[model samples]
Target: MTQQTTLHAAFAGHVAAALDALKAAGTLPAGLSRAAVAVEPPRDPAHGDLATNAAMVLAKPAGLNPRALAEALVTELAKIPSVTAAEIAGPGFINLRLNAAAWLDELRTIAALGNDYGRSTVGAGTTVNVEYVSANPTGPMHMGHCRGAVVGDALASLLEAAGHKVIREYYVNDAGAQVDVLARSVHVRYREALGENVGDIPEGLYPGEYLIPVGQDLAREFGDKYAAAPDSEWLALFRNRAVAAMLVMIKADLALLGIHHDLFSSEAELQAAGKPDEAEAWLRAHDLVYDGHLEAPKGKTPEDWEPVELPLFRSTKFGDDQDRPIKKSDGSWTYFGADLAYHFQKAQSADALVDIWGADHAGTVKRIKAAVAAMTGAEGKPTPFEVKLVQMVQLMKGGQPFKMSKRAGNFVTLADVVEMVGKDVVRFTMLTRKPDAQMDFDFDKVVEASKDNPVFYVQYAHARIRSTLRKAAGEGMAPSADHLELLGEEELGLIKLAAQFPRLIEAAAAAREPHRVAFYLYDLAAALHGYWNLGNDRPEKRFIVAQDINLTGARLYLATQIGQLIRNGLALLGVEAVEEM
Candidate 1:
């Protein structure tokens, strides 16, 4: 299929053609790279409809002054029928102002493409595996894991929208000491379910009341079969069952926020397959692993520090602070050891890998990154990889910290928040800030009807458009493209803003930042609301005109397209574009 041409893309081709013309006419040098050439809207609308740094970006390499290059470029661009004016701006930036007909044509593009309007092929032929919300299978999902969950899921969808095959994955940390702790915690609850006074959750085990049901099921099933047995007789059974139960709860919690992963990999399964052993042998053969002793950790008293010989991966070779141990002194794999194998496994089927982790894992980012680089680069096709750390979210209400849920035992469960405010609000609110920045999820402000509330404001824009279209239809007027030329300056201005969606999607996908979608949607919504306000003072400007069916169809056409674009964007964020408030 031929790619649908967007306004930004069309003008980008024009700028490139202009440069090519300069080269062909012997006015400029040949073979200059156009990698840095970009077409985007001017920062201020008053500047122009669209601006390009083609002249400015090419001037230095082409050895011509920016202003001179811009002038020549403007002369070439002025030949295009759609470009009414092309002018040189500050330094060498060239800005183009198109006639209203150009934008009205783009509004037609929105109608032709509908849901496919903003889709881009920027990431075509690349497969990205996004691993996120790998919260340990020890307890219920909570606000602590919320930000990364929403960010990662939305990012996966954004990549898909940008034309990449995305694998939405979750790594189950059902291995090492943590799951064992979870198993024992369930055992304590099991005895309690069996009418034994297990007492107030002994230290060093999960104490969440969410485990009560799991323990009750186990008690009813086993009927004291392993209640008094030694740890060797029942540890594995309880561990497997407990992890499965916790995962069920975790999945349910994530579902409440509209999240579902395509794959949930198990650490224990990876180890049982001897993947870690396989990774070690290959790294050692490549000299990326060696037996070494780590220096005493920082802040440890010299008298308290002990050095032990262990097999360490040469992570320092790839920019880590130091070589890292791959195995404990007792010959068991370290968490980093298993993690390295897991990353290598993920690199097998993907062109790139992305991990969304909590800020608490900040300290481990480098070594794991180093391992991935070494492991994948060795195969002569280095895979692309990135780790995004989502910072903490403080839950607040009534101007202070919201109390934790007793059912969750301590923290505010994700389910608790979603139930209180609805799934759309929780997901949208989680994405209001960048993943790396700290944010507060305030119960009071998030649901407020004011424009300051991004979720409410953006959704209100879509709802208003739908209401307008419905009212117009009732009066026998419907959206049409027959009189699109009737759309005026204010209407064209809205199209100019809507026209940026294609560019925004590509840029956001390239940057791996999904929050940009949220920010852009809010701006578009603001433009819609601002245009609607203009109609309050001018009846002819309203979307519906009983006396002017042709003009009303044109205006309603504009509103319908705007609403469709909003729905397209909201879907990428896994949010709902409500037809009514």
Candidate 2:
């Protein structure tokens, strides 16, 4: 698709052209780095519509006084066709105000693009592999996994909106002690299904009743075949089936949140294919891995822990706390070792990699980062990889801790929470805060209809817009750009807020923070709602002025674009634009 230039993009060009003109006139030197120069909304709305520090940024390099440079930029900036006022703020900052036509032109751009209005081309030609919700395939997905799943899925969608080809992936950790425990737990349930009193769950085995169904299915299929069999005979089979069953449950839980992955990479398959061995051999050959004895961990004593010489990755070279082992003493891949290989495989196919992990895994982040850098650098092309840590969500109901799920064994299941609120509420509320901060998913607040609830407020704004449009259509009125010149300053100001979506998308994607999209949409909704209230007291400000057909069309058109922008932003967060709150 051909990219439409946003108002921010257009004005950015005007700023660049003004600087280029300055250089051409011998007022500033050519070839100086202009990367530091930025054109953005001023901090205080009273200052101007848009502001730039071009004068301050280029003055020292150009050998001119800041005040003199500001005057020259303002003089050149005022010559732009759409720019109406250009003035120098304190400390040589240049602020430019555009005529109504400039904003009207942006309103038209929104109409022309429709659904693709805020889509950006900044991430064009880049492929990002986003891996999220890599929970162990041993139990049903619970609240612990919910936040990361939503964050990761939304981030992937945000990146795609920013013009990157994104591969949504989930790493299934099937080869581990946890799965073995799950297999054993399933075996116990299988015996219980065969009419054996397994009694209370044996210590060290999964105690969740969620495993009962898998066991019952096995009992019906195999009769008493595995019930009396040895652990060696049924352990692997049960492990595989149990993991598969848990994954089915996990997928179902994620589906409720409207999340799905493009790939489900298996840790077991990676080991079966010798991928970890391949990584280890390459690391050893490059001197990044060596047979080294690890230093004693802090506060450990002889009775508690002992240092063992093993195949350790020299992670300290990359600023990690210490070297990390790739393999345990028993010749099995350590978690980091297997994970290193997993990241290596991912990097082989994508331009960059992103992992959304629970904050509990923060300690491992440094070691894995160092390992990726070392292994990928050895190939002479280091891959860009980042790990975003999501904090745990504290579920609250009735101003107290919510009850746990019986099906999930102990913790609250994601499906249960989703069923209570809904997919849209679950997904949108998850992004209401930064991922790294502690968040409370209060059942009451999330479903509250007050503006204090962000999802409700944003959705209510869209619903109001849709309701207005339907009313207009019933009255034989429709949106039009023909009378936009009659749109007042307040209307244009509302359009300016709506027009920030494209730039917001680019900035949020670059920062890999999808929460910013949530914040921006809330502010935009507030702006639209505030403008709609303007009509309550002033009849002329109402969207449908029956006596004035031309003005009514233009006002309706403005409301339509604002609604469209909210829809676009909501789509990025995996939220449905509600027609009725």
Candidate 3:
């Protein structure tokens, strides 16, 4: 069993013992259930390692004074093997101090588990689909998409570490008007590459210079043979080629951020290849799709507003604010229709579905969730769908706002940020903030070699441990796991922090907030760094003493465990745990 389970079991045993003692002493009502009893870490560490609310919860239910019940429970808990002491204080809290040997055992478990120390089977092999960074394949990824990519990738890794069979997916928006604009953009570039003065790109078309090579490829492939043909005949070919090229560029951009999707579901493929038809049939079978007209959006007026009957989905019946249309007035499928079909396909395959989208799509959440519920006929019940909306990231340099314009072709690409600060730093910094909160990415501060830079601080702690190991090896001292018991107070404190890793993973995965991992790593790194700095003042506190080889060996073992944990945590964030600065 994991250390957390063992700790929980020990706490449960204590609670059980306390309940029995209360019954035996006749200080509490008989047959009172101890189900609400809980043992967790105290907000203040000085109180104790673990605090129980047994008395506080049972006071009124059992018709006993909280302090009197706490006192009796403390006496009962003192007999437990894992709990060294139990004290009753402040009305009803039963603070239990664990035996040092329990922590030592935890250290041994961590050492045995090594990199897998924090892994959990909470997901129990269930299938989960994590769709993220479904950026339109019309250009390279911009800075806005970078944060979502990192957050999604980290969340997938976090869930996988919790033992879920996760499939990372990316949706390709290839059948939309965006791709048509891309085709035109590439055609402009093609003419320019073929010695023709394309002049200025037309309004409402992509004008980025990145498409120059794509145009060159198009020119080389067709050689003006289809230039005279109508757009209908050549548009499809050009759109496909441009999308393929754009997707390649997009993949490269994701690679720069250390992200790669397992599946790339295409919108055009779904429509042209019978998937949408299948989805529509499924929805019709469920009585979710029908022919109707939607009310124009309220509280806002559009210049080209017109009312017309259209094919609609009864999203309101499933919990949306109102029914949503699946087809436009002109008989073309709306974006929402394709989205519903995509989600339908996902729901059919996976046990759970999670979509990571930008905050701009905040209004889209209710409609999508409603669509999922309507299709499944699971209204008023929880569905296996979660939408993680990531707010925008504002990039800054030296405390000033930094803006990039793609129109000017001077936008900060994902590649630019990754190339400047590295994939590890970029990933780590992006996740330091919660997904729903806006994040500020400062180019200068992120790479600074100081404590203010959390990425460097955590990495420095890991590197310091490595440095200690190197010093021990140079001095011919053994650094094996067997000598871990000789660890000092500072070393043991670090072990306690390491023991919390599995619990952290489980909590972060259950909460669906990967920022918890970042926070936990920061705390663990701080503990290690604090202990490392203690060596600066006291010679004996040094991990490698000149004359104490046995002590050095034990300290090295502790340091190795810390290094392993840092490496594992960094791996979860898709960050590199470097051995050197």
Candidate 4:
């Protein structure tokens, strides 16, 4: 077991023993429920290290005042070996002070686990599918998709660290009208490359210099064969070729951001292969499909509405406001239909599913959940699916809003952001806020080496540890793991921060929020920085000394453990912890 597991186990054992003692003493009624009791860190450090709500939760049922029950429980808890002091405070909280030896022992466990210090088995081998960055293959990824990519990838890594069998997926919209536009766009560039003036891109067409390369490749391969052919003859081939080339470029761009997916499901391939029909069959088998016309959207003018008879999913049966159509008026499946098929595939394959989408799709969440519930007959029960909507990210430079427009053809791509601030800075900055909260990415501030820049602050903490280790090596006083027990208060504080790693991982994975890990790393880095500053005021507190090799070795061990934790935490977020900033 990891150090965090050991610590939590010990703490839980002590709490359980206290409850048992309360039972034996007859101060508490027999057969009183004990499952709701919880032990967690105190909100105020001065209260004690940890606090429990056993007395507060039991007071009304036990017919006793909360403080009286807390006082009685505190007396019972004082007998446990792991608890140094137990005090009652604040309505009914039982505060716990752990023995100093327990904190010291955690340092040894950190040395043993090293970089794997915070790994856990909470997921217990369940299969989970995380889908994100499903940007259409028609164009390169832009700044908007970067946040979802980083958040999803980091969440996947966090789940893996917590022992989930995770599969990262990308859904490609290769069967849409956008792909047709891309083919037409590439054809214009193809004609231009062949010395033909395809003047002024027509309406409803893409105009970007990036497509010029695709045109050149097509010209070199086909050699004027499709150059003069009719659109009906070559449109499919051209669209397929252009989409293939664009997807390669998109994959390279995602690679620059350190994102790799285990699977890429194509909409075109699924449609051509009758996957939607199979999904409809499954829905029919479950009595979820029907032939009906949707109610025209409310509060809209008649000209803005189009009503048609179509095959519909009985989504309203599962709490949706209205049933949704699976096929469009043209008898082709809508994007929503494809999405239903994709989720059906996921439900059949994985034990759980999570999707990260842009905030524009927030309205789609209810219908999708309703469809899932209707398909699985799990109404009013939790489904193994969740969708997280990522809010917009506004890019700024020097306190001014950066402008990007498709008409100008100068939109900032993900590659541009990666090239400007580097992948580590981009990933960490994108995750500094919750996924649902809006984030501002200031080009000037991220690259700055100040405490205001969280990425630099955390990286600086790791670099400072390396500096200490270098100084120790120069003085021939590098500490060994065996001497870590000689650490003092500051060193023990650093060790305590390291010991919180596994617990943080468990919490983050359970919450499905990678931003929490980013916040925790910043806090841990602050602890290290404060400890390092202490050495400047007290010479005896320095991590290295030429006169005492044993003391220096102990301090070095402590510093090394802190460095390992910073690196591990940053790694989980797909950020880099540099030895030198």
Tell me the whole-model lDDT of each prediction, alpha carbons only. Answer: 0.92, 0.90, 0.82, 0.84
Clashing pairs in 3: none
Itemize residue pairs with steric clashes in candidate 1.
none
The lDDT ranking, best first, is 1, 2, 4, 3
Can you write out model 3's per-residue Cα lDDT over 491-568, one digit (the tens) per residue? 877876787777678778877788888888899889988887888999898788778777777777778878888998
Clashes of each: 0, 0, 0, 1
lDDT of 2 by residue, 171-240 (tens): 9999989999999999999999999999999998888888999999999999999777889999999999
Runs off by more than 4 Å, candidate 2: 1-3, 19-37, 53-75, 88-93, 301-305, 379-381
Worst 10 residues of 3 by lDDT: 1-10
Q: Please write out the lDDT profile of model 4 over residues 438-543, one tens digit for every residue.
A: 8899998899999999989999999999988887788667758666567777776676666667777877887789899999889999998998888799877878
| Per-prediction TM-score to the true structure, in the order listed | 0.95, 0.94, 0.87, 0.90
Instruction: Point out the higher-scoring one by lDDT: 2 or 4.
Output: 2
Kindly provide the TM-score of model 4 when superposed on the true structure, using C-alpha atoms: 0.90
